[model samples]
Target: MAATLQLNTTKWSLNSNQSDVLIKARHSIIAYISGSLNKFKGSIDMQNNEVEDACIEFNLDVKNQESTLKNIDSPLYINDYLDSNTFPNITFKSTSFQKISSNINFLKGNLTVNNITKTVELDAQLINITIQNGTKTAIFEISGLIKRNDFDLVANAYNHTNGISLGQDITLTANLEFVI
Candidate 1:
């Protein structure tokens, strides 16, 4: 008689200490600006060791972002695009997480930024799953490009006056680590 193996579903909380949410955008014609969000929380549910049908959620603190050009005294700041004072947080709630290949998955969800909500899709790649010190950890890299104008992240008067035009496409990358 053959035995059927039943896998249990596990809920994992994000390890913020080991995770990072980053953004990159083209600054002017030949430069790029990058920043990192320092505060965020997220969770994932894994069933049968698969990302398919998993529920994922993330909340990022926009006000806590660390700019790489902080010392440059640039006219353009994160506030020019994100307006963190007005929209303190950016959030994502997944509607679907589907595995397309052995290590690749597609995550579709509602992304709320600057008080505007839009449907976004990100490519998720399972980096590794490890068991260490009697604990299970899973790591994933999620990346996608979103239009700034779609979320009302347009250039401000100050930016326009300085002839600094940011790229319409903003690249978002999140390196998330989950522990069970």
Candidate 2:
């Protein structure tokens, strides 16, 4: 039998809070801003002695982007830094999965934003797979970090503000769900 497509919609969250805004201030006053993945799709396959192929997709909606501090995000959202009006979404599509073992795998794919495409690799592990109500399901906990500047997500920078600096290097942490 062929592997089944298990995921209807998976989640990938981007945290702006982790970004540091470096401004000249007596101390840093930066906090975390967060956003959700409004458009995402992926599938999971488990069969035979090994897992089958898989794919994942992601889309970023600028208007949907939100942050902890309204002052920080509203202006930044409108700036040339993000340029949401021009480029509405950032996207990712997985090409393939190379399973290393029963538990670990490598998810390799292309990520695109602002018309730039880059190769990305993610280390994914199967936390558990379960069967309930005549359906099979899989859950994976994924964690990785990507450079924000690589995709040119930098915006609303400051010269001096408290001790906070708008910094790059965003961390991606997520719990995914799928069913077949």
Candidate 3:
């Protein structure tokens, strides 16, 4: 039987320095832009070396995102887009997980942005699992895609007609590490 190793606050801490949340989108109808959120908190629970019954929760601060284009960063924090002042944080809570391979799982969860909640499924692959210093660490690579309009992030809704706006779909990527 597989050994069950559970994660608890005392054993697990989301390593910000080792984890990152990134978003990519098409910009100006001709280019692509990417950004990373600088602040977030996450919790994870792993069961029997699998994600079948695991629980994961993450909360990301919108105002702290950094993008390659410094000028565009400010706009994302305003009401025209992310509206960081009003809806300061975006969140995700996993509902379930399904194993696809020895190193991969499908993660289904609820994603909330700007007070709007939607379901998202991500392809998560376990990069590595190790035990060191009396702590067990699990590293994963996660990715997904979603339509901005679905979350009401319609700052460029009208600009789309002009062929000079952002793309409706965004790609999300993350390297997550959970320690226990």
Quote the lDDT for 37 in model 2. 29
Instruction: State, as a TM-score between 0 and 1, how close model 1 is to the true structure.
Output: 0.75
lDDT of 3 by residue, 111-180 (tens): 9888899999988876777999987888876778877888888746544334445667767777778787
Per-residue lDDT of 1-180 in model 1, one digit per residue for the tens? 999998887788878667766666666322122224444466777776665445566677655546332413355555666666899777877788878877778988899989999999999887888999999999877889878888988743344536666677777777888899
Q: Give the worst 10-residue stretch by lDDT in candidate 2.
A: 17-26
Per-residue lDDT tens digits for candidate 2, residues 1-180, read: 999886434422222222121111112222222323245567666564235656666565544545232333222222234445667665668888888887788888887756678888877766666678985666664445566577776532554323234445545444555565
TM-score of each: 0.75, 0.60, 0.65
Where does candidate 3 clash, by residue pair? Answer: none
Better of 2 and 3 by TM-score: 3
Q: Which scores better on lDDT, 1 or 3?
A: 1
Predictions in order: lDDT? 0.70, 0.52, 0.64
Worst 10 residues of 1 by lDDT: 28-37
C-alpha RMSD for every candidate: 4.3, 8.8, 6.0
Measured on C-alpha atoms, candidate 2 has an lDDT of: 0.52
| Residue 165 of model 2, lDDT score | 47
